[model samples]
Target: MVKEIERAGIPVVHVCTVVPISLTVGANRIVPAVAIPHPLGNPALGKEDEKALRKQLVLKALKALETEVQEQTVFDK
Candidate 1:
């Protein structure tokens, strides 16, 4: 799906816990997720802090969208 979207001239940033898979599948832009169960937030954190962490992850994804990449790229926190 990500490859198809890019083939159509639309940029996509894939956020996932397994970055290697994203790269192998030809995702041009990738963001590292927290974990498989809760990719957006860490349960060990307080409620508010977890929310903030999720927000930061989203913001990083947005930033990755704005970046130009010649090949598969991973945006790390």
Candidate 2:
């Protein structure tokens, strides 16, 4: 779980379509995703576009990891 991972002193970024669930579970860093079926990428898009989208999400997650937060936070694209 995200909270458990953080409790171990490791930063975690929760990527999900529904942010409220991540907040409920006490995730410190949350990333709002595209959808439940395709949380990280839009399959309808061309392969290149999907790749770019995924890359952006990874970058956002990395940024979240680098930042310090005292409590729950959501990183929106």
User: Highest TM-score, which number?
Assistant: 2
> Which runs in model 2 stand beyond 4 Å of their true positions?
none
Provide C-alpha RMSD values for all models, in order. 1.0, 0.8
TM-score for each of the candidates: 0.92, 0.95
Model 1 spans > 4 angstroms off: none
Which lDDT tens digits does candidate 2 get at residues 1-77?
88889899888899898999999999989989889999989999999999999999989988998889988999985
Q: Please, what are the lDDT tens digits per residue for candidate 1 over residues 1-77?
A: 88999999999999999989998999999999999999998999999999999999999999999998888889995
Candidate 1 TM-score to native? 0.92
